[model samples]
Target chain A: MQKNTFKRKTLPSLAMAGPVSLWMILFVTLPMLYIIYISFMSRGVFGDVVYKFSLESYETLLDSTYFKVILKSIKAAFVTTVLCILIGYPFAYYIAKKPKEVASKLIMLIMIPFWTNSLMRLNSWLLLFQTSGPVNNFLLSTGFIDTPMSFVYTDGLVMVGMITNMLPFAVLPMYSSIEKLSRSLLEASADLGASGRTTFFNITLPLTFPGIFSSIILVFIPSLGIYTVTDMLGGGKVLYIGNIIKNQFGSIRNWPLGAALSVLLIVITGLLIYIYTRFAKIEDMEVL
Target chain B: MSISRKQKGKRRQELLGTIYSVAIYTILYIPVFVMMMFSFNNQRYNYYWNGFTTQWYAKLFNNSAVIGSLWYSVVIAVLATVISVTIGTIGALGLKKYEFRGKKFINNMLYIPIIVPEIVMAVALLIIFIKIGLSLGMGTILIGHCTFCIPYAVVTIKGRISGDGYSLEEASMDLGANRIKTFLNVTLPSIMPGVMSAAFLSFTLSIDDVVMSNMLAGAKNSTLPVLILSMNKTGVTPDVNALTTIMILFIVIAMILNNFIRNALKKRAKMEENI
Candidate 1:
């Protein structure tokens, strides 16, 4: 009877969980281990991985060209993240303060852009800011500049694309966390004669730290890996880490070097995640 | 009283906040608004308005490449969604119910695809596909999408199931219901919304995916986003804009339907409560 109970219980659980476990192990975990393995292998001349092992890919990373590219990628991602925080915080704060129905509707409005293809959106940015595009045309007609300034194919344009791509990510998490803040806390601060600015800094900002952290993680990692923005907006002049990794695989045809770059990207992601774990529960990582 | 002055100051703050929010929202929608307007533009590859025509939309429909890519993307997304939701929902149930040794470790591992960069996954999968002598195609892309999407399904389903699920399941089992019967009658109905949303979310992620498709897609099978990405290199055409506008319309209709269904459910539940 004990064995029967055990059989009934464990069987269903195994039948349920077993397939996914096997799936993850076979597809996800094993592939990642293979990447690490390939990262150590040498690249053949024909754009294939040779079985012989070496650290040439890692060594190549220390070279000045690769170092500069990595730094620039970090800088771009960092700037985009900071700008997202600055832009998104106030927007999220305002949305959270609205009535529930209105807030959900406003959030829906924010999501409209995401429902469309990103390429479409990025292309629109190019068209909007192109030399003879509307923004430039309007500015020139209004005599803001004697000539239509070069707007498209600029680093500034790439930055705009990055911030735009990531702003919704920053906003949603922060908004959810901000909405959860009880009104009584703010009312208590007000009744105590605390200035509004003082209450905001002391009470509100710190309360939403988890959301901010999540936003930072979400925005920073993707921005670091973003290649399309640079490809279209920057006209492929600037090679961020993502573009570099893509090129190594695409045009350069060096599998090991690309794998090494992938390994580095993973390390950077892992480090940030480790730091994140120190601050918040892993479950607190917001999907939206 | 000082109350009037405080209220006046508060009003000013609110006004400023309102203005700031409007400006942000405008910037966010500016691109889409431009695309919508441009899709009607008579000029080819022209951002400036020469005249309004739906030529781009007409051309977009006639483009076999766009249509084929769209069909491929939808089919792949559906397959990926079905596999991920089934596997993920089951995984969520198992993890939530059992006290396994590696439970904590597995939960942490679930965040990997969420946390690890997509490019890394793409490269890793590309290598694996090649090493295993599997030619990259729709199948490879499907597997690639499934890898990341499963985590999302797991997260979404787990959240739904973890809420009062243990109590509900135990209560059902306490009755004469067998395990399968309990799941079918009690748990499935309750979690149906979560599962549906999970399906939708996975579909969106898979359909919108560019990186994995770019890597895993073969010479013959290019998804819409992958096609669009390549087109962007040569500068995107207005037909692409038209295609995007149609996609946006579909999304809007879906969201509206979802909202109506949810409201109806809420109303029915409220009526039941009153009864």
Candidate 2:
């Protein structure tokens, strides 16, 4: 009986799950623990990580410069999330109301830009808004400004890049949720003599809260840690928490400080995800 | 009177919706369209439009560095897709089939990659690699890509496998087919769509990755995106624009082909049911 049970159940289960479990443990879990571990260690004078335990990295985070970047990153991420929602929610609603074939095609349209290299997309933005680029050229000829106004490498442009990069992530989840909403509920609301605006606010918006919540989680977290958009569009001038982390690991070579900042990011992510679980199931997260 | 007023309000709302969608889509696509147009411009600086020419495309083809990095990106993407798909599919199957201890923990573990920011994960992986004396190169890049991609594959495949119950597999087993045969004949076919989509997604992600690849890639092993990052810093040439246009066109064509094949398969399945 034991042999049969092992053969049919335990062995097959192990065969199936063992590889992935081992891979995750070794590659994913262990590395994550190592980051936490190294964050506590001291940085050597030569930019190497020393084995001595110290609280100096955490102390460095308390510096006003790092604190300001963290605040700025949070503000940037918040603004980006809000902008994505304001834009993506209505677009998702529009797509969800379309026929199934049309809705899928619309979704595909959104995804097409995403498939292109993100750096390429950011590059195009640079080309478009560069001092001598089309926008400035048009403005110069039309006499909008005497000389070309500098549009590249600004916080506003960085926000534009962030919105474009994150819009699809925000839209896809909301679209899925809004599509799942039943038409009968809307009709029932209308039949009960509710105004269209009322129906939307009370019925549609509340029902799609989970999607918006997930969208917030998706957009806010990544933008907080995203260096590429700010790096390219901000032109190395605007440093966020993400840029600081990159610098620490890159030019600064402060491994303990980088690891410490990453821990901060991880904590923020864990808190948001914890909040997300309170609102909805994690499995229902619409990543695509 | 009330009905006409209501109809007008509804019409106005729809018109607004249509206009909003059109404006949003234009915002999304304008940069891409502009990039494609400038790829053919005779101007090297891409400031003002000069006469159209294909010279940039020609130059891109001859650029060995761009071509080599692209090749490396493809190779890594393919390898990562294969590894993640195999591990993820099997793991999902195991979780679905067995009532095992620590199943919840394993499932939660899958969400870690999806939840955590890429920069943190990249730095984490880099630290561990340095600690273990593992040199950064294509090998480290592959590990990084697989680490993230596996969670996506697992989630996607699990959704498909769990949606359709195991009745067909059970029936096949009852008819004296062995477990391996049952899986091959029944379970695999049902999940093939999910598997294919997961593979495509994993490929796109690996190819498009910038943050992790930047950290994990050594000097000589930069992927296309990492290469593009460097190129941008040194002043982007028109050839990069040409390359971007080509990549966008290829992906669009591939997506359309995938959609076409899926529709045809669905039609054939419907006809089979009718017969």
Candidate 3:
């Protein structure tokens, strides 16, 4: 009887879980391990990865040129995250206060642009801000400037691109959190003679801290590793860690160095995730 | 007089909120709006509006490269969605229903694909492919997509299944139905909505992927986004704009339909519970 029950339960479970487990292990786990493994390996003269294990890539990362790029990427990512919160929080709060039907529609509106091809959106920014593009043309016609200012390839425009791409991700988590805030808590605080500012600071903000943190993780990490925005909007002029990693794999062909950079990103991700897990359950991450 | 003053203050706050929301929405949408509007603009470059025409839409069909890459993207999305949904649903059910060791480890592993940056995942996959001597192409792209997509599928399906207890399944089993039969009749139907949405999400993620697709795509076999990325370097014509606008419309309509169907199903389920 015990053997029969074991066969019935465990066999089916194994049959169900085995394929996916193997798939994840092979595709996700193996690749991740390979990245870490290769990072410690040395680079060859011809830009291929040499099998000999070395700390050369880690040493190369400490070089001032690469160090500056990492610092710049972090700065860019930090500014983007802060900006996303500042912009998204109000919008999320407003939506959360609305009736259910209206709130859903508002959320849908936020989502529509996200579903559109992102590269095309980046391209639109390029066209709209090109030296002879519409913004410049409009300004020139209004006699705002003598010449069209070059806007297509600048850090400012790249920042704009980054913010737009990451805004929806930032808003969704905060919206869900804000929406989940119980109204009675705020009402009770108000009844207790708390000022509106006091109620918000003491009650609402703390309640919504998980959402805010999730937004930071979602926005900051992607912005750090994003190269396409900088590549297009900055016109290859802006260099970030993401661009450096891409070039290492592409033009430079330094596989070990690229792997090391990726390891750094993974470490940053792991650290943020660790911090996030302390505040909120991993499952509570508002992925949608 | 004081009550009216408070009411006035509330009204002003509401108005400010409305204005802020509208401004943010406008900023969110302006670029895509510009892209959509330019698809109808009869111009070589999207700098100025010459005249409104749908010629770009017509030309888009004739652009073999666009159509071909689009075909590849659709194929990859479909395959990835189907594969991930099946494996994910099964995995979620097994993990949820049965006691198992290493469950926590598997659960943690699922988050890696979702939380890791796309560039990191792309390069990691690229490195592994090169190391394993697997040539980069559609197969590798499919593998990369499924790796990320399965976790999302599992999470989504897990949410649906975890909400309801196992009483119904137990009842079905006690009535002499085998486990497979119980799953077929009870478990699967309950999670249909989750499965459908997972498929939708996976499809969208697979199709819109540029980073992974670009890295995995070798000399041939470019997905639509990868093709578009390459075009950005050359010049993005109006046809690409037309294609993007069409995709935007298709996704919006699909989302509306999905929401409508989901609501209908929820109402039906609620009515059944009442009965």
Best model number under TM-score: 2
For every candidate structure, what is the RMSD over all alpha carbons to the true structure, in angstroms? 1.7, 1.4, 1.7
Residue A19 Cα positional deviation in candidate 3, in Å, after optimal superposition = 1.7
CA deviation > 4 Å runs, candidate 2? B163-165
Candidate 1 segments whose C-alpha is farther than 4 A from its true place: A1-6, B163-167
lDDT of model 2 at position B63: 91
CAPRI classification of candidate 1: medium
Clashing pairs in 2: none
Report the alpha-carbon TM-score of model 1 versus the true structure.
0.96
Model 1: per-residue lDDT, tens digit, A238-284? Answer: 67988988888787888888889888888998898889889898788
Best by DockQ: 2
Best-to-worst ranking by DockQ: 2, 3, 1
* Model 2 alpha-carbon miss at residue B221, Å: 1.9
Residue A179 C-alpha lDDT in model 3: 98
Off by over 4 Å in 3: B260-275
Docking quality (DockQ) for each candidate: 0.69, 0.76, 0.73
TM-score of each model, paired residue for residue: 0.96, 0.97, 0.96
